[model samples]
Target: MRMAYLILAHDNRAQLDLLIERLLGPGGEDFAVIHADRASPLWPELRASLPEAAGRVHLVADPVAVRWGHSSLVEAIAKLVREAVRLGSEGAHLISGADWPVTPREAIAQTMREGLCHIEVRPGHMEERMQTFRLDTRWLRLDPARDRRAYAATWELRRLARWVDAARNRLGLPRSRPYGLWAYGSGWWSLPADVLAMLDKEMPRLLTSGRLRGTVCSDEHVVPTLVAHAFPERIAAHRRYVDFPAGASSPRMLTAADLPAIASSGAWFARKVDVTHEPDFLTLPDFHPAPMAHPASMRGKLPVSGQA
Candidate 1:
């Protein structure tokens, strides 16, 4: 399978470079498209040159400044999907800058060809995320921990938007949810070519129709909602491995202690890895990069590319 690895990176250049290098290891078949946040310092270096790996890698043009839990994250993924489709790959895998591969390349491809959209589904539709108005970005610097008072104006704007939404609801106006989409899932996942094409068609409309304008964590909601409603049959297990402990908003940073579970789990990749936590977790003798066994082709739009 010719696969497109769509990466959304903001910081951690060394880790990002290592992830790409390993991705292009011995098999050297798959290609990647990197979208560096415009506000990130790594943008200039990544755009100037990629790692010395022997695979096709491209930088996204005019990347949007991505803020956590904001609409820009959704916009960035949509842009990546459009670029991947243009490359004519059979499938696209959406990954974070902090993720690293745990399984061989072939296993990853096989998982993608299993005729299921691999997204980590959250229980229930989580209707409240959209019923209330949310600020696209709640703060300018986005570090309320440092100075919440600095964003007094932003808080006022959010308050005003909430009042407007409340008034509309009181007047019996419809909620601003787009396409009546209510499903939710994890941000990191993979999709077959047809779904990629479907997202390409629908994402622009969903993002710009003014429905998802105040959508919180649209990255986790918009695409998953579309898949749940439009292609419910294709929905299956998520391939990426990350643990979200009950009531935790973020995944725990993986350590060497988790290697056994990572290898045992059916997941092909693990996320939120940092070299500092486990200096030699993915070392040479323990883990090696090579070609994986290629499986039968993905169902539709399987244009061959150079993947590992």
Candidate 2:
């Protein structure tokens, strides 16, 4: 079961370089597709850093400008999945630039072989909240100030939006139905090739549906929702470690102090690592660069060990 790591990155070139090294190693067969934010200027530096593993590491030809609380994140993910599927990868893991593998390569390979799609399902009420308001309608494009204003405006306008949606539903007017699929969970996942292929084929319809166009954080809902509706049996707990403190809007930046917890979490990866805050963490024995392989031979080949 060949696996593809689809990474979404905007900044932190050094961190991304480290992640690629760990995942691909000198000659590891697993393929990787990196989608750098279109707004970021670090792609050149990122590409230059991986001269040795050019064959296995690919950059998404068309990258999306991802913004927080927006659907562009889903667009970026979809782009990565498309590339991975084209490469004939059997499974694909979605991760971010700040994320690093915590599970051993062998273990991750075993999980992929088992064909589990890792994602978390939210509670019933939370899911309802996500779908209740037409948050996406407020901001149709990526503008930091506009995005922030739209987000802030939602709290004050949610009640009205809900009433409008309810009235439209009762009147049998067109309403956003998210590809006629239910929304659920955090957006990150590791899915089988068949599922990814389905997504690739269906994405055009979803994008055109206008349901998800202006939705805030639709990326968090789109994939899990699709998978849950299409392949419930394949859904598994998302095994990536994240630390969200009470009342915090985002996951906390992981430091060396979190190493013990990270090791014990049984997670395949951990996120939000800052090299400046934890410079020594990257130097740990586990993160040592993999031995270089002969690039000529590894080009366009399936991972030597995990082929299905």
Candidate 3:
């Protein structure tokens, strides 16, 4: 059984470079698929520069540039899932362009074998308070032709996307929570191949559902809601090691101070490490740069933060 690390990339070239190094440094048997955002010119260089350790790496085509909260995010992710299934991986780890692993490769594989990894289900919502979260305003409303790189084109469309999203909330027609099922935020998680295959089948219907149609930030809320509702019994309720704080889609950025937290979190992965801000990463005791070509096998003395 193989786990494919599915990375979604945009213009974060520096970050992407670091992420590839860490993933390959771990050096366990793993495969990867990179979906470089079509909107950026740097993707080609980034793809070309990818190190040799990323065995069987495949980059998806027909690039659609992604806006954080828009439908392009959904489309990009769905496309990856389809490719992961086609690649015949046992499961795929859905990750962002800015993420990195917190745990060793062995631990991650063990969790998967034990079935501790969560399987998501979609939920239903019908409460009055739920009306405020608009699912369709941002990416949900996106028509690829109409929404093409709106963020890069003008300040107005970006502003309009925000304004329209706020208006939807005021009117109480949030794109996602129509049926009142509690939603989960987007972060790193692992799953069985079968679960991903199921997700491939359900993608279209879930996207169009009234409960999810208005969802603006599809990352955190979309998959969790779908998993909870459709396969509640399958989801492993307890989060792995790294966890999102309440109301946060991404985890807090890791800093020098955060290393302690990273160690303790035992999270399979954590991310958004800005090398510029934390340049002394190599000096830290737990810090070790994996050879660029082989990422998964890089291991270090235990992180002090792990004790926290």
Candidate 4:
């Protein structure tokens, strides 16, 4: 099957190039569809550097300005999925520029199919994220640690929003749950070809419903939820090793020091890696040739009680 590596990438040109190179096979049989942030200064440079021969790499036109924990992320992924399908890819492995392959290409290749989605499915709806309107106030978003003035302002706004949401909850006010019976997890997955089409079809509904307008990190929810809604039996575990500390908001960035756990995790991919912080990581012995590992072995690699 011809799979598309549907990557949501921005900045880190060297890091992104390395990710693409590692994912590519010698024959260039599979292709990639990259959606870079329009706001990034390196957008043009990154686009110019990629080898676009034979339509192997399709950089998105009219890119979306993505933000952390925002609906824009959902929009961006939907666009990428539509483009991947249009390019005639049977399925897609949705990932980020910061992720690396955990298993050999051949091993991972065996999982690609038209209707089976490989993803981690958290059992219940992320009620807090969807129940409250996590509105993205279009004001100056500054680093709270560095800019006290902006931080104080945003903090007050956040507090007000939180109070409102709490009052509504206490009052039993109605709320919107766009993707019904939401299934959420880490914002990464491998989607089947049929699932890609479903996601593409569902985008208009999501955008029009306005349910995800203020949902925190809707990317982690929408895809898995919709896939389960349409093809529940085709769902599979998301075999990606992400070292999240218990109760941590984000995964720890991977370095060469974590190579042992990463290699033994029996995962198809690993995430939150950055070559900028540890330049030597890229030069470390490649970890992709590992033997097929059982999904249960991933738990041992975790530093805390969280998703793998």
TM-score of 2: 0.80
Tens digits of per-residue lDDT for model 4 on 260-286? 887777777888886555544455444
Which regions of candidate 3 fall more than 4 Å away from where they truly are? Answer: 25-28, 47-50, 119-182, 208-213, 237-252, 275-308
Top lDDT hit: 1
- In candidate 4, which residue ranges exceed 4 Å CA deviation? 52-54, 136-141, 166-172, 275-308
**Tens-place lDDT digits, model 1, residues 28-147:** 457889999999988888878786666488889989988877788888999999999998878888998888877777767877887688886653467667666766354535557766
Worst 10 residues of 2 by lDDT: 299-308
lDDT of each: 0.75, 0.71, 0.60, 0.73
The lDDT, on a scale of 0 to 1, for candidate 4 is: 0.73
Residue range with the least summed lDDT across 10 consecutive positions in model 1? 292-301
TM-scores, in order shown?
0.85, 0.80, 0.67, 0.82
- The order of the candidates by lDDT, greatest first, is 1, 4, 2, 3
lDDT of 2 by residue, 1-308 (tens): 57899998888665576568667775556888999888787666655554246689888877877777676777788899889889999888898888878776777777778777888765342454345556444454445575787666655566677777788778887445543456567666788888899889777567666566535666777777777767778878788889889997588888888888888887888888754345545544443245443334333332333331
lDDT of 3 by residue, 1-308 (tens): 57788888775565565566556555555677788887786578755676456465677866668766665667777778888888888867888766666666655666777544463333433222233444235443345677777534544544665677688778885544432465654435677787677767776556555443434555555556556655566677333334457987456666667777767765566666654345333233221234333222223322233331
Query: How displaced is residue 144 in candidate 3, in Å?
Result: 24
Q: How large an RMSD does model 3 have?
A: 8.1
Please say which candidate is ahead in TM-score: 2 or 4. Answer: 4
